[model samples]
Target: MNLAVIPARGGSKRIPGKNIREFAGKPLIAYSIEVAMRSGLFEKVIVSTDSQNIADVALQYGADVPFIRPVELADDYTGTRPVTNHAIEYCRQHFFEPQLCCCIYATAPFLQVDSLLEGYQELHRQQDKAFAFSVTSYAFPIQRSLRKINNGVEPVFPDNIAKRSQDLEETYHDAGQFYWGRSNDYLSSKKIFSDHSIPVVLPRHLVQDIDTEEDWLRAELMYQAYMRDHN
Candidate 1:
């Protein structure tokens, strides 16, 4: 069986009620749940959350809330792997054993069905790989990055300052959207950023990290622009 686990803890410090906060027209998490269901990639779409309110919203949107996430696992310090592992074990005990699982983030408003499908296909194409997750190229070359020092700014990599942009290697970063992996890999607590994982690249315009109010505003603008262009 294929399972999709969405870990949405209630304690969002940066943006209170972040997981279920309204975005665009519907609840924020509704986007993730809707997209996951629309992808048709999983036998089950589960939302593991500590908030009853979150559970209610998830159910209202057609996602199963078979279990309320434990308070211990719902803390700010808790990571995605442990929450996912707990979900996997719960499924094994109550439902059919899941072979492949996808961890879809509740805050991923920009997540696309095609990216999820691509991750699934990549995992199948490379059986040896442990994971396939969403990523996107950095907007600017990281080699020329700057840092504030006292009253002045300095190049992070002084050696690369003189190098041409075309001469530098392109880089990418995690889009924080979703991750597709074998059930065993998640259970084993394997590292996600290593060579064991492959990336499902997304366009820069379609990627935004909504951690703060400014980020939220920027995302709304990006989403509006994207919708206008596509529609």
Candidate 2:
């Protein structure tokens, strides 16, 4: 069975009511719920949240709220793995246990159904890998990165200062959208971005981390652009 677990806690310190907060035209979580539903990959699309409001929105968007997340697990310090594990445990008891689990982030407005489907296909294609996640190449070479100290700037890797960008290998960063993995690996707390994980590369324009008011605005603009061109 395939399950899509959306971990949207209510206690968002950065953006108030972030999970249910309106984005463009609907709740932010709605985009994730909709995309997961539209992808048609998951047997069950479940939202694991500590907020009744989020649950209601999830249900309205055609997702199931099997359980309200525990308070301790809903805290700020709680990481993604534990929240995902909690959802997996709930499924084991009340519903169908998932063989493949995909954790979709509520704040990820840029999530595309194709990407989720690609992750699923890639996971099965590379049987040796434990996880397949959304990723995008870094805009710049990390080897040529700079660090600011006082009023001066220093090279992070001074040795690579003179290396050409084309000569340097490309590195990718997590797109922070979704992760598809074996349910057993998730239950065992396997690292989401470890060596066992495979990358599902997405275009940079379709990736953004919605952490602040500015990010939300930027995402809206990008999403609008996406709608005009792709939708």
Candidate 3:
């Protein structure tokens, strides 16, 4: 069996009720739930949420709310590790044990089903890897990036200032969408982006971390652009 666990807490400080907030149309979390369901990749799509309202929204969209996440794990300080670990343990005790597990984030409205399948297949194809997660290359070279010095900007890598952009190596970042790994690997490791993991690179436009109001607007705009281009 395979499991997909989405962690969503109600105490969102940046954007109130961000998880259930309407995105392009449905709730933000609804996108993740829908993709997980449509992907046909998991035996169960479970949402680990502290808020009953969020749980209701999750169930409304066909995700299982087997257990209300503990208050301790739902706090602002808590990260994905503990919340996911709790969900895995709960499933083991009450339901069938999952051989493979995927941690799908609640705010990932831009997640795609095809890419998710790729992760599952790729993880198995590469047995040496412990996990497979979404990632996207930076639009620009990071070596040529700048940083805030006391009063003005300074090149992060002074040596790269003279190097051609084309000559620089490309860097990718976590798309913050989904993570697939063996059940034991997830339960044992604190970090997912290790040498043991493989990256599933996604188009940069489909990758947005919507943590602030500005980010929400950007994501919406990106979504619109994506639809227009794809449609």
Candidate 4:
């Protein structure tokens, strides 16, 4: 069995009610729900949320809200690990334990059904590995990243400043869109990235971590571009 869990809490300090907020016509959570449902990959698609509104919306979009997330796990300090684990364990106790579990964000509007299916395909191709995730090449080298200081800002990795970007080894960052892992690894390891993990590189233009208003705008633009080209 395969299960996709979307953890959405009611509280949102960064952007209030972010989970249920409208994005490109539908609620933000709708995107992940829609993609997961349409992917035809998962045996079960569930949303673990603390908000009744979110649960209703998720169900309307064809996701199962089996149970409301605990208030303790719905707080701002609650990391994704616990929420994901809780959902996985919940399903394990009720239904058959899933072979693979996907953790998708409620607010990730850029997560397309095609890319999600591609991720599942990659995961199947490398089933020997513990996990697989969607990622994108870093826009800038981490070595060239900056840090704030009392006097002035300084390079985080000063040694790489002299080297050309092309010469530097490429490094990838989690696109924050989604993660797919074996159920046992997810429950036992407590970490998403595993020794047997592989990164599925997505185009930079298609990747956006929407944390703020600016990020939301940029994602909308990029998604529009994607539609124009693909359609």
TM-score of each: 0.98, 0.97, 0.97, 0.92
Instruction: For candidate 2, list the clashing residue pairs, or say none.
Output: none
Question: For model 3, which pairs clash?
Answer: none
Local distance difference test, candidate 4: 0.85
In candidate 1, list every pair of residues with a backbone clash.
Answer: none
Query: Tens digits of per-residue lDDT for model 1 on 36-131?
Result: 999998889999999999999999999999999988898878999999999999999998899999999999999999999999999999999999
Whichever of 1 and 4 has more TM-score, that candidate is 1
Q: If both were scored by lDDT, which would come out higher, candidate 3 or candidate 4? A: 3
Question: lDDT by residue for model 2 over 6-93, one digit each (tens)?
Answer: 9999989999999899898999999999999999898999999999988998999999998899999988899988988888888988
Q: Which scores better on lDDT, 1 or 2?
A: 1
Off by over 4 Å in 2: none
- Candidate 4 TM-score, true structure as reference: 0.92
| lDDT, residue 121, candidate 2 | 92
Candidate with the greatest lDDT versus the true structure: 1
* Local distance difference test scores for all models: 0.93, 0.92, 0.92, 0.85
Q: How close is candidate 1 to the true structure, as a TM-score?
A: 0.98
Deviating ranges (above 4 Å) for candidate 1: none
